[model samples]
Target: MPGILGHRASLPRQLAFRFLPDGTDDAAVEWTYHDLAEHAAAVATGLLRRELTGHRVVLALDPGLHYIAALFGIFQAGATAVPSFPPTGKRALARFLSIVEDCAPDVIIADTRLADRVAQFEAELPASAARPHWMFVDDDWFRRAAGARRPDGDTRATVRTDGPALLQYTSGSTGDPKGIVLTHDNLVSNCRALEANMGYEPDRVGCTWLPPYHDMGLMGTIMLAVHGGWPLVLMPPAYFVQRPYRWLKAVTDHKVTISVGPNFAFDICTSSITDEELATLDLSSLRQVFCGSEPVSRATLDAFRDRFGPRGYDETSLIPCYGLAEATLYVSGKRTGSAVKTVWLDKAALENGRVRHLTAEDAEDAEAADAGRAARIVSCGEVAEGHEVIVVDPGERRQAEPGRVGEIWVRGPNVATGYLGKPELTAATFTARLADPGDELTYLRTGDLGFLHEGELCVTGRLKDLVVIAGRNLYPQDIEHSVRSAHEKLRGAAVFSVPGESGEELVVVTEFRGTARQLAEEIDAVRDAVTAAVTAGHGVAPADVHFAPVGAISMTTSGKVRRDATRKAYVQGTLKKLTPAADALPLSVR
Candidate 1:
């Protein structure tokens, strides 16, 4: 039997990937179909020799052809793949270790850079958790992967695993990391759904700057390209962040039709890149650009489309999508070629479970009285074929009323079975059933809150991130936006609720790009502006506003502000506090 990616070896000399360290159109390295398959076959042989056929193997490597081959090789060997987040520094290694402990993998295959740190991580973990054997994918390993022995009789393709094919750990942006167990069938089915939903084009290239550790990168770009047999152009996330123009340049040079990223990538292009760069980019070849793994901001969408509209960019190419690791990615998204749709509502009214689409006059009048309070939500599109998406009050375990705000729940063949080594969590998160007797399939309870409007899904905010105060519901993104606009000195913020004397009070922790020297003179003014903006927008001032320099706000590897961790740091008096005598501020958090 032909394995999922094994058939791609026969595509002969078909180009598989052209990667650039700086994400430029210039290729630092390139690989063909045979290169990927043969190298993966070599890695599979090594895994089989070590008898890791049914065990969990962690992959800790940066984005490149070699990393991709290791992931496919694990799948080819019938061993589950667990890709670790590329560690940011020594400080973040602890959190990375916690993830390994939770998954309890049998082995860790790491890139050359992390080989030494893995030993440090092992020394820190408990004896039981430190039992995982380490395999380094250094230069020697890569050379061996090129010329290593190949297992006979298709042993690399055969499977004996009782568990799923892929064990993807959540990025821990919203909560603790857990291994999402996705089977081979689940991944194949989801890819088919993606092709059908996005209107797959056979001729165009696949382009991405997302890191391979995240689901959007691993499944959407790497696995999606391999399965669809498309030549792909891949780049690391840092390269794109450093040179935002490179992504568009590669897309234009390669005639890439498909790409994916969070809303921020498009926003960065609109804000940071110069007009000279824009003139050089011709993006007419792009057909479907899926934005997910974070909230899709309408302002960001409009800015990107308008900024590039002159250069043959189509508004219909922008697709806002909703998915989670538990669903093996690509759960539901906008139909390709559909116009981007947005609904504006009165921010005050939106807190009360009403989705009232506002007229232009109403929105202007509302914003005039209460700046930064207009709520504009973009739809995440219709549910995928062979999937059921519903909104239910998680506390009641029953379906929500049409157009009523509730937790987003999804059930489909593409949803993963459960979280690895977490029976209670798996049951609570994956075994959700609608109170209705008719539909018997289990639903995965996405902790996100959203409502359906005329059949399209509109995600509001995470249930965990919702800020409640004085019997009103508030989304932190709106509050943070208001704060950012209220003061030029403020660069970033984390907004949440803390217990007050009467009820839950709003807490806003601000991070500034400027120095404490400037803040000593203007801090009072900044505070007043923030307070006034919060009062005008949300009808209440923040209970406490603490200012910290950049990097004071905790965040996950995916760049999501870890609100819970931030709150903990704030309560413990650990978040870096700005003082008049502190001299200067550190640069922005990376």
Candidate 2:
């Protein structure tokens, strides 16, 4: 497959963007390959004139056509593109500043709308930090850049397809965000892998509401569409969050055959979409609806299918997959036309680092289907072509047994080079060798825990996020899921282990909906329900059940709950407590 810019000349007239600003049909603006190429050329020329060809150019633009063009423009200019969203608040600003400090980019791209915010953030940067040249994407700036004629001797920089093109940043769900160095080859390889896994068809259209800064959005949508030469419908992430139905409505309107989102996206669409909204959607055209970027929930998939099945949404469209920033984007995904494959494993055996089958028939034979004892593990399909995926015992640095849960290590063309500047940390993470003899490959040690069954990968949980109590391993997602189900008003939950007098104890921080009066009224009842659920479901009671207001839980750009950050806030006693007494309840006896 050709790199992003390589497609411009051949597919100049090819439909590139059917962008819906308001996530509605009336506000749609169409852009072709020619339009993108022309816009990108101007930006590239501007960067070249500024002599930033070999420098890192941070894209702190909004999520739309201008951002997309600036990204490709950086690529065309032979500079490293550092994709990022504009900072909205103190937390987001802090994260943005961290990226700037790490990359030390020579230029930062933005629009006039964010001029004030960017100025404020730049002013706050330490005197030691390098001040980047800010180029706004507003009318005045674009006109200046686009209209300026290049010098007589000046020519387009040789875009390095095989060299470093992007410094894709991690979501910092477990720790501080790190820049993942991605070359054009790596991006192309992943896009080709996705095309192979999710077979393409004629007139295929893609839709995504994912944030453009993330890999899944950058590579999966914009880059993938360019690689596949297909049209893509894009909407702002805020629009999707505010009205998820708009995502589906765009799909229906565009005849979208492929789309992608995280597990929470499906959950929101399932819980929030109204009956009238559901009736208006016709998802029959969708053949591939990827649910990834976080743990794929079986319940979320089932609910989405059940709700939209009547409206022509097929269950097979939901492809539960796995990938991380280290491996570019795609690692493994279910192939097109294949039914969703799942395995029911004994929860206890899984916690012990073993995979024990608790098949569907076994549940039927039992008097009652106990979800607490069995976990449904979804298949992320076979490893991408030309890629090798192995489950390795992280501690022993050896290949794990066939049915054992361990860290997922991958080696392939899609795997990124390493972190931007952290050589020692990058070497440790990106270069790992198995204890097995005769294996010369150095794998990217993905900190994800999972096992392989019949060539399909089944992700269990994060290796770092695993909660250990009395030497027993527990997955926090299970506990969080149980807490979410504990009350009707509960929104989101973060489960983690905090230091205790004896050992690490479980702590629960959950978000609740409704007014302050309602929260004060339901605090005790909700706490009791959560305690009972966690104890009964996971056999471990939470040390502190902190009921927080909605949106209190820290989340990554990709909608993943930042457990580590939340834990830090919780430890510092900074997390807001919405309880009547403003105190976390101790483990209550059910």
What's the TM-score of every candidate structure?
A: 0.93, 0.95
What is candidate 1's lDDT per residue for 439-522, written digit by digit as tens? 677889999998888788899989999998877889987788678778877867899988888989899999976777877767
How accurate locally, in lDDT, is each candidate? 0.81, 0.85
* Maximum-lDDT candidate: 2
lDDT of 2 by residue, 521-559 (tens): 666788789999998878788999988899999998898
Residue 560 shift from truth in candidate 2, angstroms? 0.4
Runs off by more than 4 Å, candidate 2:
1-6, 116-119, 151-155, 173-175, 365-371, 581-590
Please report how far candidate 2 places residue 325 from its true position, in Å: 0.5
Candidate 2 RMSD to the real structure: 2.6
Question: Listing every candidate in turn, what is its Cα RMSD in Å to the true structure after a full C-alpha superposition?
Answer: 3.4, 2.6
Q: Clashing residue pairs in candidate 1, if any?
A: none
